[model samples]
Target chain A: MDDMTTKDVQEPYTKHLLHYFDGTSRYVLIKDEEVPFPEGKLIVSRTDLQGIITHCNQAFIEMSGYTEEELIGQPHYILRHPDMPKVAFKDAWDTVGSGVKWHGYVKNLRKDGRYYWVYATIILNIRDGKPVSCTSVRRKPSRTQVDACTALYAKLRQAEEE
Target chain B: MRYVMTVSPDFPPGQIAGWYIFNTWLQRQLGEHIHVELYSDFEAQRKAIREGQIDLIYANPFDAAMLVREEGFTAIAAPLSKPDEAVIAVAVDSPIQQVADLKPGTRIAATDDPDVNLISMIMLEPADLSAQNTQTQTVGTYILVAKQVLQGKADVGFFLKDAFAGLSGMIQRQLRVLVRSEIHVIRHVLLVGPRLRERHGDLWNLLSEMGENDKGRDALKNLGLQGWEMQTQEDTEFMIDLMDTLVN
Candidate 1:
């Protein structure tokens, strides 16, 4: 261990971090509350290349139950509800990472531990012909949509864990 | 990686050879494999851009606005002191001498060059003319617009100032300028995508001072440029804001 080489030091730590963060949340809590997403209002948030939140609109703050100051510098995955299949976010990253738009039903955890559902569309904000950031616009999802995604995500999460 | 460079089709046909020579200069200056690809019209060029096929471009003001905002293009430089302006004209033999004489049904010829059209429409406001009151016939090029006015198919024609200048002297003699826009801030710009960003600083240095050298001056002459001037993000953002205001 004392004779660890430069190549060994760089390779292991890099691969280790990638595995730890991939589709993983930093924290989670559960509470018996469900917040209703107001109709006709869009919830928008912008994140940097690494998925750190940069900007958020008023609807995002209200839906997430977080203040603007608290939300700006956090990882967007802070809202990763336990019910959401990690593969859903992985798919979102894969699509937007390749400079394509991603559309999906997302269940998000609020600051107080309640959950809300949204129909989300994600796109990259480009500069110098490279994607530098991402913007996600969310709208209210129908009850039918939420129920379908809920059932589908449960099956996916079970398959992933097994 | 191989890179593609393109220009707005609005450039005069006389400058086609000039651009090939300039492309050669760019390759030598950057020491990279850059290929030239030109489109016949704005629609085709925009299609290529959206598909992410272009690595660098010398774009018109209107398309430049879209590139900066919608696409991930960075503006590097623009032609020094060469702001784009619009010109409105009538045939030398036309009975209408001024805009004031223009009637509600006056026939107008125009191209879809957005910036020029915006300014041209504003100039027509003095005559109580508008999209509803005036008759507009969209043509393929400034040349066709000029031809329509000369043949009396249209009583008036709209052209970008440089495109009008590119017309032959005989065409110039046959037309009378009703007015020309003096908005001195809008111009064509050179931009690069992320692929060529590594050369951004060096490209700017070479371009901003190219007018001082002998070979560069020859290339500039072919493109009708005096020199390249530095364009920052703020400069481009300001112009985009102005265009949005005009559009709204």
Candidate 2:
């Protein structure tokens, strides 16, 4: 049994270092724990078109398990969970690239190898009819919606791998 | 104060000339006491919203959702449209039958409207046609996309189902549906600003009930839409979920 604990991960801020193990190497971190979302709070971040973080709020920094300095220049996908299907991101890019707002449930991996679910609202900042950047506002997702998305994402992943 | 209303330029500048005529009739029905003016520029509409100068607006589902969520506006009603109502079309004689048949060099045409462009991109996903792979021509309107495909200027076109359904017989005969997207999105929507809803709920109710009433039905017919129906919680939620999945 892998008994990696938070204390064991002395260098928790390192990008590729891990403190949790899910028994499978497919994911960078283990989903051994779930993070609790704060009530009536929002996790907010802004990214360039390539998804390099430009700015993020304190709540986003706290929930993401990354310090503000570590997150600012990093790609937003650093927190992506392996369980997510590529199709969802494809649809999101297609929608937002065309200058429309997109909403979806996302499961994000934490720096400590835990995970949390959020209902994310992403809007592209349009300048001269083209997207210059994107802003995302995230709130805690309902259990029902999370369960529904998990099943749907599993199906999508199966179809994708085939 | 006169209420400000804006329309999306989903249709080309002069093609749907009836829109100007229809909004004029709608303003009269809303009563001269509630003066309404119509404009179609999206940038101008965004400006008005940013400045809190607009009162009511008729917009695509994406804009309507954003306005309601971020701009102190509320969705009151949406036009009657099927959830998954966008269709990709090709010339009837073309060999392209399914999404996989689309090649790297194939010419794609779509309206400049954001909804149409996004739906077309989503529809093309199955073919793995990314920005690096395929090219797109932004035609002025849905009708022009159909015309472009039919005239062999483009290999495939994207348009709303209603636009294709209302095309001229000859043009309709020349095009065939390549695929219909499975993603459901709301069509046009009606939204009222916060002040309008707070201080003039009765007036707002009167406008909202127009679709179910007699005079409102006439205006709807002229506008080429069913009467406005109240936006349900389920509908708003669906759009919100769809918005995240469909972003570029």
Candidate 3:
């Protein structure tokens, strides 16, 4: 609450109208302005089996628009944009469960209801021969990658809604 | 209580069994149930570290900083006389004699070995080449990096100095070393996390005396190491500080 920055969003706010996998959807404003991902910096985070954030690096905190104290112990879907198709996370969980790494271009919503695109790679963390958690590192995706993901995600989102 | 020990993944395929032998020797000498878990890359290994899954680790110089500072891993020892080094090379026929001959748009093929890539990038600073300016291609292996340079697909290749030396003689003759990092202070170190803190002293003493016995000496040879060099906390902090400086 105190850590969140409620930036002034001029774009009219819109509701999901139909929602799933999103928990406690507080910020409903979807600004058309995109926050540019910083160069030469990596956003890294770790989550428990339930996808609750356990640790986050400074770069992640800066880009995510949420303070460190607020982010930890919260579900990672806090950054989930309604525009993101649920299938992306479903595919991630399905593949990562098999000890495989998953990589995709994603548009993550910031605390201010702004968005940024990243090339994210996630891997399963194992303990005593058992899977325990997940670690993800993300970097700025190229313009071409962002453009392609935008088109593909739009189609996927439309399909999910219909 | 079974502890999990992991090694850096950059070791040669020939050294896979060597690690197992070393692990077996460690368990026998320490009188503990220690299992070896092998991760194919740094991402997985780092994840395990963050998740508190790894108890003991043989880490690269780049990761040593994170392990000690971030994960509370205490440094114990390093392979005697083995310093991890990096080399940047070009094809023998290429006119690039020194690193300064490199240009901004030069295509550089490299592996994801963080220490090697970090030092190699610093070396390229003299030539005004950088990740922002250079066309960098990440190959799967050192040999593939060499292949990229030899086939003129990349103007330069970055490699682990040891891996480059391990290349076949025929291939070695085809490439020329542009520059090799001489930061001799950096080396792979064995570290124990908080869970294994109590056994650190016993483990260090055993490694120090490992060379006295034939079986222990044999295990060392299998891992391509001579002996163990005992490390103090000061030694570790200095090295990690150096690595932090270099990384920035």
Candidate 4:
């Protein structure tokens, strides 16, 4: 467990340093350890149209449990758990693609199959003639909101799978 | 006061220059017995209608639905042009050539007004299109979405056909239509608040009949070529269906 935790910590920084030289990093720091894991802090990489995982910070790797090498070329959905609904992601994508911010609750899966809930905000970065990348930040969500969302998402997921 | 009926945001308020022209003409017809107040935003106009701020509203199908559902406003007439058809487009160079080409991880751009644009997009869903793994961005306007797609910022965009009329040449040369909706009668509907329904039945009848003469034709021309038509529960039902699809 200790080895795994240590690997998680070093992997993200190494990945960030290797892929992104601009000194910008994606970091997710949990402000309260006592809070539920799903309610903790989360930071995601900013990527361009090619979907490269250019940068990640320590907290992202620690929580996701992937080595730096495993995360870099993978699409963001690699972290997507099976429990999430396709429509929620569809809605989120549609919202951000239009150059508007999307605020919603999400349930993401960890590498270990544990699920977490987050209050997520995503924004698009347009530079020059194209969209450079999108950045997202997530924080521990209210239990009330999560509980309601989980039930709704479960129904939506079931419908999609059917 | 003269009553001004304005189409909600679903229609091109800016393009519908006829509404103002008609309002001025209608004022002449009414001889100052009533005044017109035109509005483009549905939510704002809905609030005004609910609070008894306006005597009449020229609303879209969706707005008319909300009025019937929540506030008991009566639909008086629908516009001549069908408002339900939404055109989905992508840059010519984009990999998305058809709705089926939209795969997981595809980045799609849409307008911020989900109730209007998003609902229209949903109505245009292809039989085999699955929205899995799609990432979407919601800009506030159709033009912004077009600019984004033109600049290669987004892979797809959805907007009304009329909204893109000015850019048709550029779009035809640079972009491809992924899908086009069947002709649904999109209308700018006339609605009366519950309080004014009985009191103003004659006004409604007169307005509907006004298009039979030169003065009426001029007034109709001013109101975006929308002449007076009868209101029906069916018109209200169409709007309700749109609203239901939006929420679901």
Query: Whose TM-score is greatest here?
Result: 3
lDDT of 3 by residue, B57-138 (tens): 9998899978987898998998899888888889999999876567779999998788889878867764556689999999
Kindly indicate the candidate among 3 and 4 with the higher lDDT.
3
lDDT string, candidate 1, B1-248, tens digits: 89999998878778999999999888887899999999988899999999989989999888877797778788899888898898999999888886667878989999877778877876665465779988999998999999999999999999999889888899999999987766566688898887788888888898887888888898898888888889998567555544543442
Between candidates 3 and 4, the TM-score winner: 3
Which stretches in model 3 have alpha-carbon errors above 4 Å? A1-162
Q: For each candidate, what is the lDDT?
A: 0.79, 0.68, 0.82, 0.59
lDDT for each residue of candidate 1 in A1-162, tens digit (9 for 90 to 100):
011133222322111111125444243445556787663355767799998999887888988988999888888876777777778988999998997778888998776666798878787766556776777877556566788888999999899779
lDDT (C-alpha) at residue B85 in model 2? 62
Minimal lDDT window, size 10, model 2 chain A:
A18-27
Q: Quick one: ranking by TM-score, best first?
A: 3, 1, 2, 4
- Give each model's clash number: 1, 13, 0, 28
The count of backbone overlaps in candidate 4 is 28
Compare candidates 2 and 4 on DockQ and give the better one.
2
- Model 2 chain B: ten consecutive residues of lowest lDDT: B32-41
Models 1 onward score TM values of 0.59, 0.57, 0.61, 0.53
Worst 10 residues of 1 chain B by lDDT: B239-248
